[model samples]
Structures are given as C-alpha cells and as structure tokens.
Target: MLQRVRLAVFLFVLGGFLPSVQADEVWEFVDADGVVHIGNAAPPASRGLVWLSQTPSARGGSGSAKGKEREVSALRLPGYEAAKPHLEAAALSQSLEPALVIAVAAAESAFNVEAVSRKGALGLMQVMPATAERYGVAGRILPDGKHAAMEPKVNAQIGSRYLADLLRMFDGDKELALAAYNAGEGAVLRYGRRIPPYPETQQYVDRVMRFYRALIR
Candidate 1:
C-alpha cells in the first residue's frame, strides 16, 4: 500500500493527470484490499472502494477550474522552472518566444542542465559542440578550464541563437526550423526546405511542437 502511494505521488509529479484535464472528472479511490485507483470514473461501490477525492475538469469554466488549469501549467514540465530564467534571457536576446525555447529544451533533454546526448550534444538544449562553437558558446575557460556547453546559460544562449538562425534560414517556418534543428540544414534543404522524412526528426518536430503549443496555451 505504501509502495502504491509512492507510485501515485510519482505519477502525479510527472503529469499523469494532464490528460484528465480534458475529461469531465476524475476520481481517486482505494478498495477494501488497499489497492488505489485513479481514473475518470469510480469503480463499483459494492467492491468496497471508498472514494478518497474527486476533481472537476481543468477546462477553466469556473474560478476553481481556472485555478486547476494554472496548477496544471505549473506541473506540465518537471524541470522547466529551474531553467526558466536562462530560457527567458536567451529567448529575449534572440527575439524568440520563450515557450518555443522551453519546448526545444524539453524535447532535447527535459531541461536537464547536465544532460549529454549520445551524439555529443550537451546541456538543456542539447547543443552540439560544433554548433556551440559556431554560436560563440565554446572555448570558455571555466574554473576547470573546460568548454562551456555544459553551462545552462551558455547553452541556452547558443541554442536559442542557433534556433533563431534556423528560423530565419527557413523564412520563419517553425516546422522547417525544427526539422533542421533535429536533422541538419543540409537534410532540410535537400528536402526542398520541408521537414525531412527521417522518423526521428519527424517525431522530434512533433514532440517539440506539442510542447510549444501546450506552453503557449
């Protein structure tokens, strides 16, 4: 039972209830055997399932619903708040939307400042070393005299500028820009400035666009 409770808490923190916002309602109950359940509808009362709590839809039809929407937004991205300051700064400096930057970071590394990709991409935005150098984010003499791609602020700045340039290159077409960001500019151009047909790049663009729409909403 304790383990189930812990799992429930973990799911809650991970936005398990995000889809529930579109449902009419949600119920939390525990059966006589101490099994917990959460869903849009409660189980049979004859099963001795005691209702623990209920929440209305998060559609913002009322004051309470609006508050729930706010809560959902706050919980939408787990590590986003920690990277918000740098994201905002980078976005403003690049004349980009902060939500777009956040979406890229989320899709790249889930806002993990220390994340490194298998292809040598690094930090929240997963800027490649060469790309970092192109954006003047490399060759920093840290206390340890290491490159600064691992630094959150530096990575965000470089990645944001890279994205802005992609946007400009693609004539402000976000889908094409995201495709170039995921694949490569050559691939995008080879596809006639359209999104490449690569499955991974397609999926990455979809995920980042979804995150961007959610954040902007």
Candidate 2:
C-alpha cells in the first residue's frame, strides 16, 4: 500500500491528480547537472535527491493551508533555512514580518548569497551598492573582504530596513512599497503614487505578494 501511494503521488505530480491523494506536499531535488526539480514526492535515492519542503493540507479547521504552502515554497530556496535567523532578526528590528523578508529574498535571488544580477544587484536580496549605502550597509565587509551586500545577514538587514521604510513612505500600502522597491519611488510617484505599469515591476510585485500571502498565514 505504501508503494502504491508513493507511485500515485509521483504520477500525480508528473501529470494528473489522484483523488485519493492530496498534492498539498512539495519536494525538491537537484540533479547532477545542477538542475532543480520540484514535485510532490521524493525522487529515487539513486538520483541524488534531496528533500526540500512539505506543505500541509488546507482541509483542516483553520484556513492555514495556503500559508503552509507558501512557507514550504519559501523554504525550498537553497539557503533559506540557513538564513532564517538573519531574516527574523532583521524583520523584527525593522518591525517587518519575517515572512515578507523571506519572500523578498526568495524572489530576489532564490536565496543565493553570492547571486549578482546583470544590472549589478548583489546577494540574496539583490541590493545595489547605492541602495546599501543609503540604508547604512556601506563600509561593511564580509569575512572574505567582499562587500557586505554579499553577506546574507547584512543583506537581509539592509533589505528589510529599506522595505520597512518604503512601506511607511507609501502609507503602509504593501503593493506600492514593493513596486517602489522594484522600480523606484520616483516611478511610483510619477504614476500618481500607484504601482508603476512597467511589466517587470508589476510582475515583481505580484510574485512577492504571492509569496508573502502564502507565508504570512
């Protein structure tokens, strides 16, 4: 029966659903070539699979199922669990929600502490050097003598503070704040203090909001 259930889950994830099986759980594994696979069941051990996260069912009394799903999704990032302490501390210090910090980090760089964007954004939060300076994260260096933005804790702290400031600037409108974070406060204000119509910024806000809602509970 256990074997059958596992097969059902695998098939459901690969293609269709099994009425007897719920797809509430999520898992991830990396292949030899660094390809990541996300699904509902653990892959074969011979495939060098690593378990990522498991979401709870939403059918319970409270409607926390969605939040569990988002939490699992955020946790699936490679370094998220390792960086949770930093995220929590930063968020608490800035009066921001930890989940929001995690979600932004997830959306920004998939938890890659060394990530650098084409436009020169750096670290887990993709903070540019200028933004880091503005947030008082400048002049800090990692153990390797790299910019502090390349460090997870420093990046999270600066990013959380920036996000908190944006929230206050936008009158606590999370969507607008996120937009300003992606595009720029000038762009948001240019559009009459609304989310800029720029497709990239709009999509960014939506993605962050999805992650935020899923994790916030």
RMSD for all candidates, in order, please: 11.0, 9.1
Model 2: residues with Cα > 4 Å off, grouped in runs: 1-71, 139-145
Q: Write the per-residue lDDT of candidate 1 for residues 6-72, one digit (tens) a residue.
A: 1132122221133223333433333222223445442233231222212434344433545435433
Clashes in model 1: which pairs?
Answer: none
Which residues of candidate 1, in runs, are more than 4 Å off?
A: 1-78, 144-146
Candidate 1 RMSD to the real structure: 11.0
TM-score result, candidate 2? 0.68
The backbone clash count of each candidate, in order, is 0, 0
At residue 151, give the lDDT of candidate 2.
Answer: 83
TM-scores of all models?
A: 0.66, 0.68
Please estimate how well model 2 matches the true structure, expressed as its whole-model Cα lDDT: 0.66
